[model samples]
Target chain A: MIHNLPPGLIMILGALLLPLLGQRLSAWGALVLSSLSLFAFWTTPDFHTVTLNLFGQDLSIVRIDRWSWIFGLVFHLAAITASIYALHVKDTKQHVAGMIYAGSAIAACCAGDLITLFVCWELTAVSSVFLIWANGTETAYRSGMRYLIIQVTSGVLLLSGAIIHFQQTGSLVFENFLGLEPGQRGAISDLGFGPLLILIAFGIKGAFPLLHNWLQDSYPNGTATGTVFLSAFTTKLAIYSLARGFAGLEELIWIGCAMTLFPIVFAVIENDLRRVLAYSLNNQLGFMVVGIGIGTELALNGTAAHAFCHIIYKSLLFMSMGAVLVRVGTTKATELGGLHKSMPFTTVFCMIGGGAIAGFPLLSGFVSKSMIISAAGHEQMFAVWIVLLIASAGVMEHSGIKIPFFAFFAHDSGKRVKEAPWNMLTAMAIASFCCIAIGVYYQPLYDMLPFETHYEPYTAAHVIMQLQLLLFAALAFVFLMKANLYPAEIRSTNLDTDWVYRRLLPRLFAYIGKLVRLVDSLFRVACLAMIKRFLNWLSKSCSAQGWLGSTWSTSSMAFWAAVLLGVFLILYYL
Target chain B: MKTKDDNSKGGNSSSDASWLERNVNVVIAGLVIACIGSLIAQLWWAPLFAEKHVEASHVEASHDDGTHDETSHDEHAHGESSHDGASHLHPAEFAVEEVFGFEAMFGFAAFVAVVFLGTGLRLVIMRDEDYYDS
Candidate 1:
């Protein structure tokens, strides 16, 4: 019974004990425990669920719903794959942090109230930083710190909103909160603020514009296995949270539109395969966020299904890059080529993942991605739909084709290397298969929708349109390449939004520091000059020839002291 | 057509053959079939799976608007209306139903199985351990 044994308690117990086991066993053991817990939750009868009260609030610590189940299932599966992938890793800190990070996401999904969500939310922030730190490079360390600061700030906002909402409404139910009531300014001033706070919290995790710098900054810098874990949980969790909290909020449509557009152009020119995928991840989240914004039963279903499929496909893409990096010692498209000769298996998996991401006619992405695109159309948001269609073409260019085309099949770099490790390949294979399975037979995904919609994804028109998009995009790539108009892969940095923090902000701080130092020095000189001037006056005044000469200095001192004391007495009395 | 150096550079190509040799049509076909097959199966399974979920909730409560407009109008015209209150759920009695339950779990299991089996097959065929790095 989950009620009798709350999963959070089990998780806390596991988090505490797992680290005590030796390094090798700790990660694997924690993963096994999480999987077992998932099984326990799954087998436990829905009618016989548990409730627990913590901190003067009764909450459903083991609630079962389509939303929670979707997140929980992926979290557990991701944990298993991550643990297996990290088996060769010797970093105990990363391993422990990963387990804690994943456990928190699962715990959050199971949380019934805002209070519970806040606790798990903060926990996820604290644990995930180690993944970035696991890179053990200066860039990674700095990026990890930035990630922690943003994530914690997001949590703080959510917590503040939650506390305010509770004080105003006298309840802490996390779901279906329609912001602050009007005309009341006690705690929660507006409904918009509550969703805003939660949206910002999710935006950082979801990698929304402005708040998304951390993903591009930190993901590529993490260890391969850590990146795999990074890909699976945090952003997707935020999308789930947004879907739960901010569905049908119209502003999200524009926000989603912006998110969908910005990443593709960046991905088109990006050098690092992982960074490209990071941008693609942002693009994918845009689709889900748009779905949340649309808030139709079909759209929400699309969001959930997209999250599910996105996790697998993105991870597959990352794993392929990881595999390439394993052999070639780099993931830069410019530096990598002819990998297909030695790593044919990884290439095959990558192409599958690429196809899925590009929304190829019969891949997982097609099934879920179409739902959001259609929702936009259904809502008569013709502009958003058109942009999304353009972005879909960009997805294929940057991810579906470019990633593999450059890394594995471009001008051969003449580097001969072996395939990825068995474990690594195994994980990639699993993820790639899911990417395709979701597309080919989308009915299972459609039926799992929380709301019923009669639209079919496989209608001839939909498939034809999608195929045309992919074909035309491929043709465009060929046309550009033939014309030498396509951007050539270069061995240099391509700036992302993170450039704000990475370059501009730090430079701004340094410039401010320099200006402050100059002002400080100038003030010191001016103070010295003022002291000299005062001394010159004092010398004349205190000398025998001066008005207040040494002959009369004692009387002058006494007079001044008496006047100052009198003034002080008056001021003190007043 | 160009410089001697350019001709030498062009002739000394070692990377081109490996990529062309590696495409090996058979590998591409296998990947296509596996990916397409699983996607179709999952698509077919989603809706039937979701329908099973809707059946579980015991009640689909809908309160009918039983009072006709003429009757309400007559009562209102006679000034016979007495009660005036907004319908609200009791906080203690409010319950939220799980709209879609095992549907996600079923989908997840199917996803995991399909991925593992497909990748496992690919690994068997590829044979080389470091298939991705090269």
Candidate 2:
């Protein structure tokens, strides 16, 4: 509202001015602009809305409430840190794209109406693709293409759903589709067709189970710095959208459970450390989705809180990997080892990020993730609680133990590289600081929740259990290492759901094309053979020397004439 | 690979190996201590940490106590984790969450199982680095 415009639009429009700032200074310009937008967002009064009447319908362009505020503030933080991280890059396009993408996501969360949300949603898709393409690899470009298609398809679904929703409800206000208030439970059956489509739209963006391949597919393909940006906004925005629109939807619990469970296994075999982080990202999102599904005040608070903390720590993890990628030219676990010998600071940062993700005590993940698990326990969903517990152990296995263990401390690949750039280090340090700060002093974060909560994260039982879970998981790693039961880090591509499109479906279509060609060739060959046989017979029959066309007809006629005369003579004698 | 690694541009070209690499045993020892410490901590904190006797805790509690030898909590100053009549599927005086080393063992077992599953998963899903491209 600094210029009586949406805070996100401010960053988006201000991004235009960034190119004028020149390549060298544009990154700093972005940092400044996001900070400005954050300040403007901070000053916005609670529940403020800017509605525009458009063609007989009210289009709410901007709305600032508790939900958007928290998301917006975190988006701003991400933008500033990402901008700082990208300061070493002279590419103006990445900066511009980064700002616009982050801005649109912020705008999308703040959007009061579905139309506005849809516009920003598409903007996020269009703008963010450049980050992947900036890698300048064929793999990255193709991955970006797939990413754009899926994201644009999500946007299309959102728009179509919005139009239908308007027809049915005569309002495009983004609210609970089931018309349930926060903390009120509802079933998926209660939703209209529009809401279901909208849920899918959110689900695609949210990386919901089967719809999740794009996240693991594209994120690892992005530029080193760009993946850090990619990790922060898109899925969390979907989590926010789902929380706003589909909270308490009963089916989300199972979907979230599935979302959490599979990624850890995929992460285990994944050779690309970046892809491992991507899978880990999906797994983390599952916890937030489950929180939103539970639809209790504490659970919702957990979702919001987890989202906030996740953006920082996940960004930190990605940043650390990006550092590795920048220095060593690969984040392949097989190629990366004994990095602590050279890049000790980077190694430390990576471990901190890993520890944060694994929900070590007094780390950001611990404080935030527990809320969701406790909510599950509070609901007494024993199976779900147990699954979540297993997932936690899985998280420890992959992100906590494997990422740090293999990347920094395992057998010496003997690659000696410098520490990350000052700007990158600063960004990681800032994010790391935020992780610890939030973990220790969480009340301020708790205050930003949409609902009131006295949910405590530091209970004696909770801490001990979490410690036991994590520490023993670490011990298991040691045991596995000692017994040589741990899987060796091998250079390989691990199959995931993306196999459907990237491999299976494309191969299916290719086979289909081959089958069509096979059939067509066989038919043509058979027809030609038949035609040749017919012509040969026709030629044989029409030839002058052939029996049918020859003078043998005359001989047969003479014999018939003699026989007829003999018969006549006989008749006369009788 | 070694040739590529030889391009050590900056930051401690002097050190051939890190202290961590030299003292891997020390790190492992620390982890072992932490694991043992966590189990010991559970035993100590079980009394003060016992929360409500959540109804569902009994099911897992009873199952856990079935392997009573593995579970480290026999000295139940509080009743929640006690194996006597309290560990039955019936409503316990305390929650099953207080079961000493239960989470620890579960975490250890689950981690091993997940890693083994991952190793097995490699048989089905792992492919050459350019599997998709090829």
Candidate 3:
């Protein structure tokens, strides 16, 4: 029965126990439970499935395949690493929420049916919001609400899409929607509304193009360690879902291109280093989306490989920035500088992460990202290939140079802080090691791909070309800096898509509320004036000495009664 | 007397500041040197290595095809080349492989474009930190 149990159940159940256990015990419990789930994933045979008949439909709760395996394994790894990093946190609520969020993402990855996917998906949205709220600031509270609304909206879309798809096809089985044969691509217009809705749902989570505002809006506001966990799971899960359900959809190519391109601009102007990382995270997802859109064996492999590598390096970068936030109490670029003199290990780890993200040679990104670009070239999509090439350099600008440069090597801010704690250092070291290992010895990663990977990453030409791109980008940074053409880091907020929701929508609602209040008061005053006039008339006519109030009232009343009775009798007779 | 003391203090602090500046300059110079070295290595050494590998893979692929008939050999070679072109693991043949410093030039151009693009965007959307505080 334990073997047959869903892989994520252990973590969810473990989360429930976190409150009962002491803080130290709960942290240990998270690591153990996460490792146990990882062990379960590995031990579970390929194509191993557990089906439950619920509501007259067979729901696949545990569908173990190569695709799900990679995502589930990475989720478990992220959970363990994040738990380790958060060991210093005393807040039990964060611990519980983090474990549950990781569990839900894992459950979603393994979910074989749309209904199951939707349930786990919503659980992830619900549980992850607690991580944001754990900051216990007003801004964090507001951002958490916004994050929750967007996430839950994604879940609602997924549910609606699932229902529509089920009604149309009479099946809830989650699989690729396009029904394209291998090597075939599908156009966006060819998609039904149901799948398109689901794609949009994934798009929101994946931080796709314009729908990506929630990420930059909320991620920087999360607790230091919570952001680390947040960075690893949610968007990557969306990418996994997209690769699973909508691979080879050509529209994703342009969407992916826009996703990669637009964030670079925002990241360049972003003051918060963590927010910069969030934009960088969006840019990285673009590469994966482009791969998924390409929908070839190599491209799909690239998507999977990139996701695996991105989770490691991105987590490492977040952990480094998180360490900075924890030590210095701010990740604002204006406030940080020359941290390497103090937090040397973190800087090194961050540099390694930056190098990997920039796709420098002998780093994980160089190995994984080339697959997609190579796929584009082979397909002769010249425009997309060129855009990707440009985006590659753009990634180097923010994540590669700007992040490490401003945070660690720029003007010293005179704040000397101690290095990060052992637990955090260990987590970062593990992630950094993975980044280097995947870059240098990528054969294992390639072999683990869902499809057979024929591409090699360590080619002389590929390595040189990538080095040329990265180094020349670095050279541009030098030139710009010498010329003072690079934008100066300033403490300011830049308007992004979230501005519509965070500012404009609230103002609009307040204005409407004022109008409603004005109308209500006017209506009340008019009614009150009418009532006053009626009262005045009544007092004047009916008071003593007015009209029939005098001595003649008696005679008038009797005569009126007699006449009324006579009329009534006549009408009754008639 | 007070002014003299203040001047001495200022001089001492300035000296300390200069020391820090010197150390920072040294670090920057070292990094710049390393970057330039990498550029040189990429230009000089990488192409040679690439040529060797490309030739080796080409020979191996051709040998595999030689066992087949002429018609199938051509087809297999075409498939192999296409496969290599698409595969991430393999170094795909580029149309301008012989073009020296193409990646470097392209990278520089991309960086300039991205920076200009970012600056232009900032002009339109930049706001005070308190823009959202209200």
- Choose the strongest candidate by lDDT: 3
- Report the C-alpha lDDT of model 1 over A1-574, residue by residue, as the tens digit: 4545644455556767776778777767766766776776667554344567777688766665777777777777777777776766667787778888887888787677787788888988888898888788777887789889988998998888887777777777777554412111111233555555766677777888877878887788878888988898889889888877777676677788889877776676667889889988998889888778767665777788888888888888888898887677778776776688789899899999999988887788887787777666545465777667766766877787789899887666666689888878887777776777778777676665555444456643345445545654554555455567566765456555666675679789999999999999999999999999999999988888888664655787899899999999999999
What's the lDDT for residue B33 in model 3?
A: 77
Q: Grade the docking of candidate 1.
A: incorrect
Candidate 1 regions with alpha-carbon error over 4 angstroms: A3-12, A19-21, A47-49, A179-192, A537-574, B1-16, B19-134
Ranking by TM-score: 2, 3, 1
Weakest ten-residue segment in model 1 chain A by summed lDDT? A180-189
Chain A TM-score per candidate? 0.89, 0.94, 0.91
The CAPRI classification for model 2 reads as acceptable
**What is the Cα-based lDDT of residue A342 in candidate 2?**
71
lDDT of 3 by residue, A382-458 (tens): 78888898999999999999999999877666657899999999999999999999988988888888876656666
The better candidate by lDDT, 2 or 3, is 3
Residue-level error in angstroms, candidate 1, position A136: 1.5
**TM-score of model 1 vs. true structure:** 0.76
Candidate 3 TM-score, true structure as reference: 0.86
Evaluate all candidate structures by whole-model CA lDDT and list the values in order: 0.68, 0.83, 0.84
Worst 10 residues of 2 chain A by lDDT: A453-462
